[model samples]
Target: MEQSHQALSSKSEAFIEKENKYGAHNYHPLPVVLEKGEGVYVWDVDGKKYYDFLSAYSAVNQGHCHPKIVGAMVKQAQTLTLTSRAFYNDQLGPYEEFVTEYFGFDKVLPMNTGAEAVETALKICRKWAYEVKGIPENQAQIIVCENNFHGRTTTIISFSNDENARKSFGPFTAGFIKIPYDDIEALENALKSTNNIAGFLVEPIQGEAGVYVPADGYLAKAKALCEQYNALFIADEVQTGIARTGKLLAVHHENVQPDILILGKAISGGVYPVSAVLANNAVMNVIKPGQHGSTFGGNPVAAAVAIAALEVVRDENLSQNAAYLGVVLRTGLNEIASRNPLITLVRGKGLLNAIVINCDEDSDLAWDICMKFSEYGLLAKPTHGNKIRLAPPLVITETQIHECLGIIERALNDFR
Candidate 1:
């Protein structure tokens, strides 16, 4: 068994070397080379299996290669794939209606990636501010939180506080106000001080910022403030939506409806790249034809895949499952933390959880721990150098979650 594992490791190393040589040096992925996945499990090229803890940064909420989503995509692909918005395709209208109704929005603007949806939302908000809210053109200001991880676009990164993502990408697009996360006072102050505020974009849980769950009532209070100021409250649920944070949308945890909602990642159950921005007619209708569009945004396959993905979220009750299993995961991790000194704190909401390592920001302890976890047949990644985010697929069962907990503890014990 050891020899076979060694051979598999060699094969994996060869694949990694090839990728390093051929592929862009942008992502420093785990050494494992995965070729297939099902549910919460992924198999490497050598057929070694491991639990998928990251879920592609919460993209695969329905689990890897969900059959329903894949079936829908396959059927749609076979039928009709792309018909640019120039002509009406059969699937686009039904999908628009279904998604709008599912999320309680009057309309939706579809896009291909989370960044594109975010950009769309930003453009819409600015336009609405000038056209509807009576703000001057090019003077619209959108408030964003520090340590935000929206996407890699220049306009999006202009306001990001992450030095790695911001440095050397200067001359960023302006018209953004940066505020501290979870600070209602800062939010209110910005609203009061600003005359041309268009919208306040925020993440309910701050997934990429190490799953930083804000204080209770923060979102509710912030939404109230946005309403008070007549500014749009935009929820970026790209990472925290679709049962990843124990709710269909994390904002639902506060029972507050955002004026503008940006959704992506798991909207198609990780089967395809599909994103959308939803708003009422007053806000979404600001854009005229030829103002904004994506050629492959509302294609037939994406529409079918997204509908099936959302249906699975409802039929399988993934949100409730995530709510229940999140408690289990956090409780198990807390128990383990009590016995492990290396773990300083465990924080997050639902399955979107992370552990703060008792080490410096430059320390590689978290990365080392993830490598050890991979060795033990589980997969996770580190963020901010000293934190590791553990978010598995919502389709995970209690038994599988408990098994993962055992593996996590064993890995921690080995490291300790």
Candidate 2:
């Protein structure tokens, strides 16, 4: 349906109220109640057109409701949706072959969401450390970064420093160490400090912590340190993978390949819940049958959707577009920051970008700015209290991006 130039009416308010009434208040969503999305745009129930600056947290890099991906999904769903890993399904084998080859991995294990895939990779790493690296069972330690947002899973939250995610959630799980991100010295110290180190799991670019792009060569150096210490270099590319950072994987920026790669979000173009963990024989073979499995993982419909989603990335040359547009976006945002005192900083790679508001982290100024942005026909979210992430779909055209930049500039001006 085409977007009509209307305000959020009682219709939108009703939906929000209904959700607040019944649903768990786990998420603090922007007040805009999205009802429909197409390309890089979303519409509320009242049919107001707004540029989708978030891209469902970079899941719709292929763009929302893409026809090719949806078509593949529909065809598969009509034929066979699930047969379980107990019985082979036609789509699973082909998808495994396609995705493994596409990402240049020797093998792939599928799961349904980002957190599940992360858990799966952790299992593979610890098992590899015990069975192969000869670490005593239950003593293997995985290194994570401070301010990393892997997921809400209990095991992941064990190593996290985020108070909101960790508050009252534990007695958290152990066997993990947290380190400062983008610090090569910290990584090396952690690695050399212990013999029972299983792996170093990290995001190529920390997306949730306000799109914090690490220093150049951090990933490469970290991976090399892991190799030197005989530990796995696991890259959690769930948010930064699949051409989101102008490379198929953010580590590609430094020509580093991970020992274990975890992916989700855009893997299925955000049309379905699909995640994958890719590794070579040495690491992956550690997990035997019944050691780990997901009933919904590798289902036929997911297989079909993932294959199509990946194809769209290649066919559209999204990596190149993102690379070029990233330069344009950062340049533009930098210019805006120069003129707008409200915007203290702008930083990111490709479409995954953020602007720091000139306020304390505890201040709600960033949230208030987002409300003004919504009024001006753009949708973005504040992270870390005083930073707003601006990752739109990679499929956005230069013209549309400039238009959105105008909206952003105007929104910043309003704050002045």
How high is the CA lDDT of each candidate model? Answer: 0.92, 0.91
Off by over 4 Å in 2: 1-8
Residue range 1-416, candidate 2, lDDT tens digits: 11223355788889989999999999998778888999999988778889999988889999999999999999999999988899988899999999999989899999999999999999999999999999998999999999999999999988988888889988888899899999999999999898999999999999989999898888888988998999999999999999999998899999999999999999999999999999998889988899999999999999999999999999999999998998899999899888888888889998889999999999878888888788889999999999999999999999988898999998778667
Q: TM-score of model 2 relative to the true fold?
A: 0.98
lDDT (10s digit) by residue, model 1, range 251-366? 99999899999999999999999999999998998989999999999988999999999999999999999999999999999999999887899998878999998889798778
Superposed by TM-score, candidate 1 places the C-alpha of residue 40 at a distance from the truth, in angstroms, of 0.7
Poorest 10 consecutive residues by lDDT, candidate 2: 1-10
| Superposition-based RMSD of candidate 1 using all C-alpha atoms, in angstroms | 2.4
Against the true structure, candidate 1 reaches a TM-score of 0.97
Model 1 misplacement above 4 A: 1-8
